[model samples]
Target: MESRRTAVILPGRSYGAYVPQLFFPMLAAQRRGAEVRALDWKRLEELDTIKLDKIARWVSTQVAPVLKDCDPASTVVIGKSLGSYAAPLVARYGLPAIWVTPVLISQDVVDGIKDCAAPRLIVGGSADPVWDADQAFQLSDRVVEIPDADHGLMVDDLARSAAGLGKLATGAEHFLDSIGWTTS
Candidate 1:
């Protein structure tokens, strides 16, 4: 029997999994028959100190049980902004991933992605200070860079933001296809 395909969402601190930017793409993968799981850490917000490694560890702890029996090769992790801390766990599991507006300023995030053997698609905007498009390109040829887009990928023009959403969906679809995660 084929292993079940799973799509896990690791949302940014400010942006939850249901946010349109992260939600729509994960919904697309769900429509393709992948089980969608989201990790929410409310207590993290209340915590005073938020170190990168600690955040990643916390993410891994939240994610471990859900993925305990799942095949890493069949899993896809979608992480955004602060959620990008999970990148190291994704790499350790040897899973493909979709990173949107990741914290490239964190050397750990950059190094984790560099160490990931599975396919990865990094998305960011030139205007997002937290995102390093050059480093993203270096880590993965599969990258989507939106001009004038902010950390949330929202631009001054609503219509442009809508257009960027379309692009984000397309990029996600391409990643799914490349990974051979087909719909029934």
Candidate 2:
């Protein structure tokens, strides 16, 4: 039998830890009996000054308890932008993941995602400067790219952005289901 799973959301520097709509993907995991929680990091504004290694260390410390208690194979990390730096820690444990608008430009982030052995999903936008669509494809075939969307996956038109978010939610559901986390 599969072990009890946990879905940890490591939000971007600007993302809300508890924003219901933005995290519809986590909702699917919750319905599947996964314990879901969002990590609230301190000193986010200072993230710009800190090196990637330091940020990674801080994130690792914050997520230590979850990794310690849960089955690593069943731990699913959902990280975005700045939070993507934590992907390596999850990879080290061989956990599945969903990276939203990841910092594709960062070699460390790309390498971490590349090293992850479990199921993974990458979501980004073509217009996002930091999003490397090709690199994302190379890392994981499970990818969602929003046309014309910017770094935050927001396009010029609000309707387009909403549509993109809806797509992302659908993709998230599919990814979770593929990993055997679905109620179905």
The stretch of ten residues in a row with the least summed lDDT in candidate 1 is 45-54
For 1-184, candidate 1 gives per-residue lDDT tens digits of 7777788888888757988779867987897888888888668764457665576677667766765665876788888887787777778778889998899998878888989999999999889998887898999989999889999889999999988888888898888888887666
Write down the TM-score for model 2. Answer: 0.90
The runs of at least 3 residues in candidate 1 whose Cα sits more than 4 Å from the true structure, single-residue gaps closed, are none
Clashing pairs in 1: none
Clashing pairs in 2: none
Evaluate residue 85 in candidate 1 and report its C-alpha lDDT on the 0 to 100 scale: 74
What does candidate 2's lDDT look like per residue over 1-184, in tens digits? 9777889888877766555334777887787788887788766677688776577676667666666666766778888887788777778888899898999998878888999898899999999999999999999989999999888888999998899988888998899999988784
- My TM-score estimates for the predictions, one after another, are 0.92, 0.90
